[model samples]
Target: MPRYSSRQELVQEMRKRARLFIGEFEEIAEQDKDTLLADVDRSPAQMIAYQLGWMKLIQQWERDEQAGLTVVTPHPDYKWNQLGPLYQSFYETYQDWTLVALMAEFEQQVAHMIDLTLSFSEEEFQQSGSRKWAGSTPANWPVWKWIHINTVAPFKSFRTKIRKWKKIKNGLERIL
Candidate 1:
């Protein structure tokens, strides 16, 4: 993903990648959502859940900061180095949700994230350390970078994963 110069560019990419990513889930059978493939690490359900986790976390961080609380970079419970467990926690968090529900919630969260992005001014998007929660990283990344990483970047990568999973699943079906 390219560096977003403005919030509009960021939001545009968010919607574009998110649409493509979520669209792939339409072909995934609900029963197969949790079916892990030999190649792809994440099931269809896990992929959506991971997205929801990050979207919600970003929203929460902004909410906390707005409420005048010191914001934690990722989450209060997990440290930067413990991201593996953190991701597992995300999987567990939405494990019971049906794939449809997960996708619906992800869509809603994407819209909310877009709204949140629009809420920020161009100056905030461009300037590093604009948001305390966002700047806690060593690089002091701008708000747009955080948004791009959490949204557009992962959406594209996860889309590829799901596509690969789909092909693998189809191949297995044919062989069996």
Candidate 2:
């Protein structure tokens, strides 16, 4: 639903939101990184891994589309409605990773996303139906929408989740 007039605006917004999102993790203690709040099913580490997984998936979609291959929206083995299992896969893939390592990998992925975005021309960036994997049923989406959903929207949403977890955890700690 959001629109960007230029690639620079899109990139800037993505970077800003991502920085704020990742900054939330820096406030959490290393030991508390895995603490699952009462209302939240995922720990900070799991959330980071999920973000990494989606970023990688988006990048892969771009690569595959550019190569003239049929692009799958979520993945070959997973459907849009099957995200729970896909998320579980993300957790399993990074299960042995420490919070610090996960964060570093996330940062690297963000950088890679930025680079990929920069490679697109303005028309390619804003053109509707630019990528077939973006879907065509209800309405065609511009490439910017795809990038925004994968980056900006999730960054903002997950930042709030992490903040909520910290608040609840800290509140519980004080109560105890």
Candidate 3:
């Protein structure tokens, strides 16, 4: 896990990584967007759907906690151990969506996250226990960590996955 010294740093990193992640999609052809890679089960559009789904879930958790409701990490019906099913649900939720529509929704969610991040105070961003729903296992993470894991970190990782998917589709040499 990475730590941020300030909210600006977190916001900047989130923007940079998200831009890099979303930029990968521009290089992909519309027809290839739905093609599944042999090594990965998800199509490129489905991958973006998964990321968007998680972002929405995090927002819901934050909203629920702010309203003084019990926050369920991941989801209410699903536990940490049930992530596979949860991911399947994400895929199913966006299965009918076109790539263009998914891209528009992804951009909207990222903008929403950026706005949400900007609204946090320095203390709320850095101090642990700022959000009770964040949980205490493995130490209580500050709000920034929650934002990083759900946004920046996953964007960096999923960017790599999409790049690898592109290479595999083109029968090019693997970069790694």
Candidate 4:
């Protein structure tokens, strides 16, 4: 029998996948601990490593929403300048069953997501698609963060093609 189909089942599945992904991260991280991974191998590790971190963040956010938690929208400010040292640390702890400091840092961010669920009202969600999305789970459709996208999308229309303004469209408007 299939183990899961409902929401709870799905969350459990995601957690399980996260665990497995961690295992893979350790496998790769161990291999490179003593040396820099070639460009071929290193970049993917970086990407998956980063995404694994983000998955934890997104899931914690989802759990809060499921429980009707409330807060404001969140800006993406988790990572900025620190990466090289973190990667070096990962290389230092390769192949261990235990977590490297980078993983610990990621786990800490996940915990913060729990604390900072970006709580918002339904109205706020309508105003910003991402406010609603911040609470969504990966089990659902992959979230497309539209927080950066304005509520009104700017797309050129047929009118743009047809309209020709007579020259004096002055920057300063006439007072009538």
Candidate 5:
């Protein structure tokens, strides 16, 4: 939810949140990545896949636009209301990978996203309609907003989810 005025600030926050999110998963056992609990909506592996999915989608939109192709918001196969199915596809896409591999991919994707973000100009970060794909949304967010929404925002939110998951797994909570 933090608003960044500069690309440097955006990247800094992105990297910081990513570290915090990934750090939460470090202590989780690889064998337990797919273990679903009674409370948490997603498993550890699902969390990584969800992040990876959105990051890849953002990169794809940028790549498609840069290549002079019509870029899709979300995807051609899915609409805004179809997000649940889209997320399921994301989980299925990376389900076979080990937790360690998913984490590595997530880290790598974050780096790639940061690099892509740096390629934009300060003006582009502030101005709406900078990218057709980004502008297509009802919110009409700029490129930086898209990046922050997919990266920093979710990283912070999901970090909390992972913390709760860890607490439950470790039985570190009280019934009160």
Candidate 6:
């Protein structure tokens, strides 16, 4: 039997999960410059970039679909390496947003993508061609899972971080 459901519905679930990330993102943003600068194992930007990557792929898929440009034959720019540049460009352009707001944009973009793809009829969706999809980066076969993973996983991470940071921030605030 052929598989069904173009995307994993993970992004949709992630939309809810992303909300849990907001509080953590706020604490991280509110971190004293000293704390963030001293412990530089990773930047918040790095974490945001990962989510940005998934959101971007969703955005691109939506764009192509709207343009009626299906069958995304693999091209050099469409490669994984190219994804970094697109992400960096987004960061550079949207540098003003706080982490929470950026997360909101991420949620919005993914939701738009899911709305676009989820509406596809079986005939339109199952047209498996030379198309490159977000899930295509992992294993093309489990595109739906990739979609869900990309959409939901980051938000879950965001939520966990938020919860931890909020607790810490609250404690720190109590000390003052």
Best by TM-score: 1
- What lDDT score belongs to each candidate, Candidate 1 first? 0.92, 0.86, 0.85, 0.35, 0.92, 0.53
Q: Which residue pairs collide in model 4, if any? A: 30-94, 30-95, 70-119, 71-119
Per-residue lDDT tens digits of candidate 6, residues 10-104?
43455566656544565565333113322232245545655776666655664675688763523324555675565566556556566666657
Return whichever of 4 and 6 wins on lDDT: 6
Worst lDDT 10-window in candidate 4:
150-159
**Candidate 4's residue-wise lDDT over 1-176, tens digit each?**
13222333333443444344444434333333323222223432343344433444355455666677752223133232454554444443333333364455545543343233234333443332444444433322223232111110100111121111101111112422
Candidates arranged by TM-score, highest first: 1, 5, 2, 3, 6, 4
What are the per-residue Cα lDDT tens digits for candidate 1 across 136-157?
9898988888888899999999
Each candidate structure's TM-score, on Cα atoms with residue i matched to residue i, is 0.98, 0.92, 0.91, 0.33, 0.95, 0.57
Which is the winner by lDDT between candidate 2 and candidate 6?
Answer: 2
Off by over 4 Å in 5: 172-176
Q: Model 3, 6-43: lDDT tens per residue?
A: 88898899889988988888877777777886887778
Candidate 6 residue runs with Cα over 4 Å from true position: 1-12, 26-46, 65-78, 81-87, 122-131, 134-138, 161-176
Candidate 3 vs candidate 4: the TM-score winner is 3
What residue pairs clash in candidate 6, if any at all? 7-144, 8-144, 10-148, 24-162, 72-131
The segments of candidate 1 whose C-alpha lies over 4 angstroms from its true place after superposition are none
Residue-level lDDT of model 5, residues 1-176, one tens digit each, is: 67789999999999999999998998999888998887899999999999999999999999999999998779999999999999999999999999889999999999999899899999988799889998988899988889999999999989999988998988843654
Question: Model 4 off-target regions past 4 Å?
Answer: 1-4, 27-49, 56-99, 106-131, 134-176
Candidate 5: give its CA RMSD in angstroms.
Answer: 2.3
User: Which segments of model 3 are wrong by more than 4 Å?
Assistant: 136-138, 172-176
Taking all chains together, the TM-score of candidate 3 against the true structure is 0.91
